[model samples]
Target: MRNRKTGFILVEALIVVACLVALMAMLAANQHSSMRETQDRLRQKRAESAARSAVAYVFSTLTSATPNSVTLNDNWAQLGGNGNQSFELGDLTFRVQIIDANSRLNVNVATAPQLQSLLVDQTMVDSLLDWRETSTTPRANGAKDEYYTGLETPYIAKLASLTTLEELLLIKGWTAQKLFTVQTDVIQSAITQTDTNNRQLPLIDYLTVDGGAPNTRANGSTKINLGVRGVTLNQIVQLGLTQAQATQVFNRIPFNSFQQLLGVPGLTPIAQQRLLDAVTFTAGNRVTGKINLNTAPSWVLQTIPNVTLDIANTIVTQQSTGFTGLSQLATLNGVSPTTLPRIADSFVVGSDTWIVRAYGKSGEIGTAIEATVVLTNGKLQIQKWDRLNTIGIPAWWNWEEEPTSTTAVGTGQ
Candidate 1:
């Protein structure tokens, strides 16, 4: 009887031991799952915080002063030549870029000739035009509703301004692969010639449709008037001209319109184009779409009428200190008064719209955000905002290798 009782007790003990072991295993699994969830939540919070901080910092810088004053202060230089700047905040590291929208071609506003010069694809350019125009009639190489209706997932043509960059993917013959190939080729060629440190300049970098309506404030107010009585030498200097050229401009002042600046003594057609690219001369405090002379690449400068490659190169080389006025461009080697008028009205000393991209990372988890904002009448308004899966790091980052302390935390811009 005593042996039987001992056996039963032993069996019970074993059974209890097995149950405790199973419970321990289950608890351990639960703990691991909980830990993973916690880590993911922490990473997501960090990413959101980092993105908001970046936007706040950029907007503050943009609105700190007048648009031209911000450029004159050289604040945009903080973003670096390739538009990539990295910095650290708390436990998160961030890579940020601020792109002047005016530095890019406007799909809605660029002429056919200008689009041809930039895209080098007549058919694509024609398609782009057809997509935006209200008419159903196709251009020489463009597609219409009929072409779209034939697709596997048939849809009608947009016949309106593009609301988003992704809309390009829907255009006929604009495959994702083709678009990527073209953009990659263009960026590769540009970096090779310009030594842009192997930075990747995506297609979106060269194009935009946002900058607000030309000559109209975001608030619908009229632009500050520009004329002899309203204009000052200081304002003329903002045209990228030198003090001497500004003085000359002042002498030529009391002018009636922006067109009159083309006739300034010794102002070359190229210089005038540079001025046009950098300033707005119409009445009312309107913020027109104008390129920033301080930031535009030689290729972008070439988009101006009568601005040859050699002339563009001269402008780029002489822009070390950046242009405070359009007259400063006249000091370039080949720029004479004869060529300035042709390019006037294409540029502005300040930027009203900017594309800000920020990347945040913590350990293996990372997130990125891209935003387009416009500054008008001292107010900052966000036009577009999106989160990205990849941060688009440069080739030099060697992402295949293990991240280092500096790379993981990011270096200041």
Candidate 2:
């Protein structure tokens, strides 16, 4: 009887000990998970703060630059190109990149063939154009009011210009990857890739809604408005026109369009380009998707109708100084009488819109914000801000390769 009692007691004690061990294990796991989550939250807060600072820091370089000569070589573009430039803020790191809206093909102004350059087929182009049309009739290959309305989760066609580039996804057969993916591979070239690099970049990289602006000089000086004879004859002569040519050209306006000057006799190509730069006959404050000849990527220049690679390269080599943006291109080696007018409409000299992408990171946690910014009348304003949840990294930090550089950049940073 004594042995039986002792054996029972030992068994009960063993069972209790096993139960305590299991309970302790569960508690430890819960504590570990809680710690991890708290760490993640702290990282996130740091990232958010850094990302916002990056946007302000990067754009400060731009507002200080000369308006007419803003180009790919500018500090903002250099910092943003190829990869994100990094700056350290306290314990966190921030990255900033910039894209000129005027550098890309503006769907609002691009012709059908111009659209074709970015796409593989006419289906998306035709459907996109049809969607933009106010007319009820759809192109044969495109979806319109009827097709969109018939979907299971139906919505009507947008029937106008896209207010955002993301609107492309709403069109028939569009997908996220087709619009936003950026491919990575080894490549080398002297000219830092802007628009024309050979990479198979996503359409989103080459498309923007902010690609238009008021027709004025970069310094906010109004282009010499020629409508109703507002410009003086001497102003015309100063644009490189002969006295006879200036008088004839001056008398011809109240011109309907800038194209009218091309028809005037004895105005050389230099005068033609200078005249285009300094005047506008049309009534609107805006034009879209015209090339900023001073800054466009060589590939973008080639995309302009009748702009050959040689011509694009020639334009790429010359520097445009002062207020005459496109005038510098008129007398380039490849620009002849045959090529000038054909490609004339493709040129605009400066940009008012810049797209800023900034991300700040704390360890692996990150926050990104994309903003559309406009510079007008000597003031800078944010037109829109889109929190980019999945815009991805500018470039993976090679911390092991350059441990010192992984440190803070710049004195203030």
Candidate 3:
């Protein structure tokens, strides 16, 4: 009874309450930590599942669309689910630029009006023309000789090859930013020659892109001729073919009917290989009279008669829910009666189509994982991935971080 009375003292009671509060706090802290860990693991698992689901969509739907190749050159429909709900895991809303890798450049194969219709800035077209002209010292419009000569490095000694698209920064009036705007759909890599010494050497044996056009020019002006010099071929005839030589030479025949070339016997192993490696054929415009609206990218849609990016993205988003035809897009949020006709002639929905997916996890710093799939050639091939920079990603995967944008972006968009 005495001890109990002592324990019931006001100070002791307050101490007991304080101890209880601290113990409770410690237990709560441990529970919170456990909860957070569980939530994080769930988030990670969900993200990974989303990625797999996205990949599955590409493999199934996109691959079935085409047997030849997958293209990332145009519009991408919504990949999975719809509405605010569509914005869930594996919910991919983005634009893909789908075109035959071998398709002729709209700017090059196009008539002047058609080139204008292709909907790129007039200035970009002008610069392209300037570069295509047979001028050694081609100065882009609005740029002077000093500007070309004033490069941090000397302008390429001669335009033996196209400088990468990124090199266009050296062009007058083209900033790095402007290049990004114009070249998003385009791929840039060195079109390296196997042998620079031989004029008719076999060129890019590994020409990528769908519909690999033979001798297609990067500028849509010049053509690559991967062949033996006619003169070299003639010289091969002067040397009598040993039996082994004849077999090796015959193996490298360029023409299916070599009966005509049989009279000339001098084809060397190298020359014969060149003939076999070369592709002289050209690719016609598969996109022809129709502009498949469903497949066109937002940029391509913007090029449509009067649609802006907002309207274009809107049209693209709406088309995901099974766009039967271009006309059906009139029901979209921003579509007006007047804009309908213009869009109709410009876009085609639900024809030859592919899907591009961009989904990733976000952390305090920024985007953690991102993937890009080009649904072409009837398979979902990863065009690029930017998460972690390598292995898990490819070099071309692009991630756009939340803009630190204090100022609004320009009208150029």
Candidate 4:
């Protein structure tokens, strides 16, 4: 009996030992997981802080510098330039890019011709017009409230300017995949060319609605300032003049009136009529929403009446120091005198608004902040702010993972 009791007690001791070993293993695993989670949280927090700091830095720099001296290409060289500027704040590294908002089209103020230049789909263009106009009547291929109400999850058409680029998804034909694609090579031929890659250009990259309501002419329409100084000869040729006639027009400058062009020898009646229809001599040069000569793309420049591809390219390349005055553009090699008066009212020397992108990274965690800011008379106002899960970071970072979340950091009117 004594031997039997001793054997049973030994078996009980073995069972207790096994249970303790299993419990210890579980505790060890829990400790490791908790440490990893804590580290991830710390990194994310640091990244967010770094991103905010980067944005602040850009705003401070812009505010302190002379507005006319700040060019999108020069101030934010990393955006499209060969080199990148990055700095470390403790363990977090931050990168920033600043772009002129005037470089993009303002949907609230864009004309049909201007919108047509950017989108290959006439239907999409008409649909956008229909979406913004107060009329219930639709254009030939446009969508109205009736079209949207017929969807699987019915909604009404927003008869107003788009508050966000994502609002296009609610329209008839736009989708997330179609809206964000990049068109690396875009061929601009005509408005109706279906083979063009303009459809692939992301709407977010080219449109804005926030920079204050544009100034309206007495005719109840937005006006382009044509007084911008760099009127090229090609732009003048587009005004119905032959190469010889345009050259004659190029030699003259600083015309106070269209009547002044009559003094140019061999000014034909047809050329005079075309010039009258296209050119405006009013000193209303301070119109709101004019494209910044310092940052507008060559294609956007081509949309101006007289600017051809070659002339537009020349204008972009010659603006290394940025045009402090329109007169500076008049000095380019091929600029025509006739082009100056016609386009004099169309451009601004500096920009009042800018698009700022700031990226922050800490360890494996990263975040991006995109903000649209308006700086008028040195007062800075943030119109839009978004936090992104993924952004095109510099190649040196070796970041390959996809973003985990996309959330709005904040928004303002």
Candidate 5:
């Protein structure tokens, strides 16, 4: 048989070897793919488990409170100082900060200047003011048909009503970066509907006090200033109006209803709404407060003074584990006293909900996954959970930390 044709031809042997190699490669690749999927699934399961525990912890702590001791609407001062409680999971750590949104400017009710300060963009501030001023009733200046047609089409002449904070994106010069830089809550929406044409603009847009350019001096122009300041409110009672008059006007505004001051005398249409936007009257002096450990954006977190992006991110990543109280922040390598103080007022621990967010490992991927949680009645709940790597997030509740320990070594006994 000619020695069995020398077993096989070189070409045939080569082909068989190629086939074996191909099969090995396929098997190796399949194994790797399966392992990667399994690892991801495990990571997700672990993260979800941590989140549930965090919620349970939040509810247990708050619900166990004595009656009248901790009400749903209790303010910062009422909550007292932060404790040492913290939540940790895997490589994650979390803390809580309850803030009274009323104390801060409500973008919906804030004025142009207040918005400007919050945004820190002169052009954006000026443009918004110009639009509001020029767009009077039907035929406004800044954004009339003629003005809008000049820009890139399909041009939206004017926003009928700003239902969400993201609407600012339509306006010229406003970018996602610029809007988010100031920590504006894109999840929040505002509707400024003054039934009558001449009706006073809602004070919701004037959340920040009239500051910088349009500020009111002791002896200046005739413009009635609308600013919400501790000093201004105090002066309103002591100087502008009598104790009785101020009381009457003040009484008109109850919990979360400071916008009524738009009708107060001595206020221009702009000033009235500005003040209204700035003022938020809660039932008590203090109100519920919170900081989304996960969702607190960079700018807001950076406002914590020396907090670096890395530190903020670390805190965010650790959020699922849970946070007991405020001090755990010091555990971060870079966080120091200076940063803490600057950021302390900007954040609160132990009230309400939170969202933890992080970028994907690959820079090309955007908006990896953002976890949202709601803490009510002391329990933390996941209101919305999403992976924003694909479609953008929509506005919706509609409405809508950690540490270590030390012990004593020496004993007196």
Candidate 6:
């Protein structure tokens, strides 16, 4: 009986030892997890700092330099053409880029046909429009508050215009892959693509809320509204038009589009510039989504109502000399009298508003600053600034990207 008792005590001691070993293992795992969590938090904070600092740097640079116009070849876009110069704060790396905002499609004011050109399904396009309208009424293919509220997680439609591109993900059918880049197999199978490029530019690259500006001239002067009151023939002649050309264009009581006046036979560049400086079809001072013909890529150029892919390519080819005024546009081969009236109002030679994007990464985490910049009083001023966390780093940069449209610029602190 004593020997039996000894054996029982020995077994109890073994069980105790096993329990201690298990406890030690649990403690060790918990400590490791805690350390990982701490590291992640630190990295996040650093990323946030990096984003804000980059924005501040851009703001300061613009304020001091005060560029009047932002174009594709400007130093701001090139970052002094120095790709090696980058912000390196410990392990974080980033870059800063200035994009011509007007060189994109403005979804807020785009017509239904224009929206359809984005290759979005009619349902998604209708839903995107429904989300922006003030009313709760849903389109035939769109969702209102009801559909959104019935979702598993339960959310509401924005019921207003989007302030950021990130808000697109909240829309019914839009996804990160659709907005930023096309990288995943799931996306490849989901959306039927018409683009044949090895790497297609996403819809976000061609869309923006702040893509255009108020119908103001590059000189900050209000353009005369020929749609309401007619300017005198003297005013037309003073703009460098000959008496016959002036009378010919001026006889039209009210001009509808700049093309109506600009498309006159043999109008000089100076005359075209003056007509642009002095007239607009829009009566009121509302914002417009006129894409800059001087700086737009072929992708953005093709978004014009009647611009075919070949026409867009032709225009890009002629951009070597740059269109200082709309006069040069009429001289292009594809621009016919019949085509001029249809597309004249959609293009502009000068642009003021731009997108200043600062983005960077640390390990796998990414951050970005998207700012709407406008040139005011010969200085760059911030219109809207947004700091976005969890931004996906653009993949087209190193993937032999067609162009730098997808190149990510950022700053680090």
Which candidate achieves the best TM-score against the true structure?
2
Candidate 6 Cα deviation (angstroms), residue 7:
6.7
lDDT of 2 by residue, 283-322 (tens): 6666666767766667667667777779878777763332
Error of 1 at 9 (Å): 16
Candidate 4 per-residue lDDT over residues 330-383, each given as its tens digit: 566655766765654456555666777777889878787778887666677888
TM-scores, in order shown? Answer: 0.70, 0.85, 0.34, 0.67, 0.40, 0.74
**Using lDDT as the measure, what is the rank order of every candidate, best first?**
2, 6, 1, 4, 5, 3
The lDDT per prediction is 0.63, 0.69, 0.38, 0.63, 0.39, 0.66
Model 1: per-residue lDDT, tens digit, 186-275? 422232112354444344446677653245322232333345355677876765677777777777545545557667776655556555
Ten residues in sequence with the least summed lDDT for candidate 5 = 209-218
Task: Judge candidate 1 at residue 322 and give its lDDT.
Answer: 65
Cα lDDT tens digits for candidate 3, 1-413: 98878868977889999999999999999999999888777765555555445445445445554322123322222232210112223332221122332212222222333334442355544454454344555434433344456777755322322323334445454464443332333223212112122221111111111222112221223322213323233333333445555454444544322223322356543433333222222234223223444334454455445566688677557544434433355557676644543444333222232223334342321122334444333445665443333332222323222221221112111
CA lDDT of 32 in candidate 1? Answer: 99
lDDT of 4: 0.63
Off by over 4 Å in 6: 1-18, 64-68, 80-86, 126-160, 166-198, 213-223, 230-232, 247-253, 259-274, 282-287, 378-413
As for TM-score, the candidate ahead, 2 or 6, is 2
Worst 10 residues of 4 by lDDT: 404-413
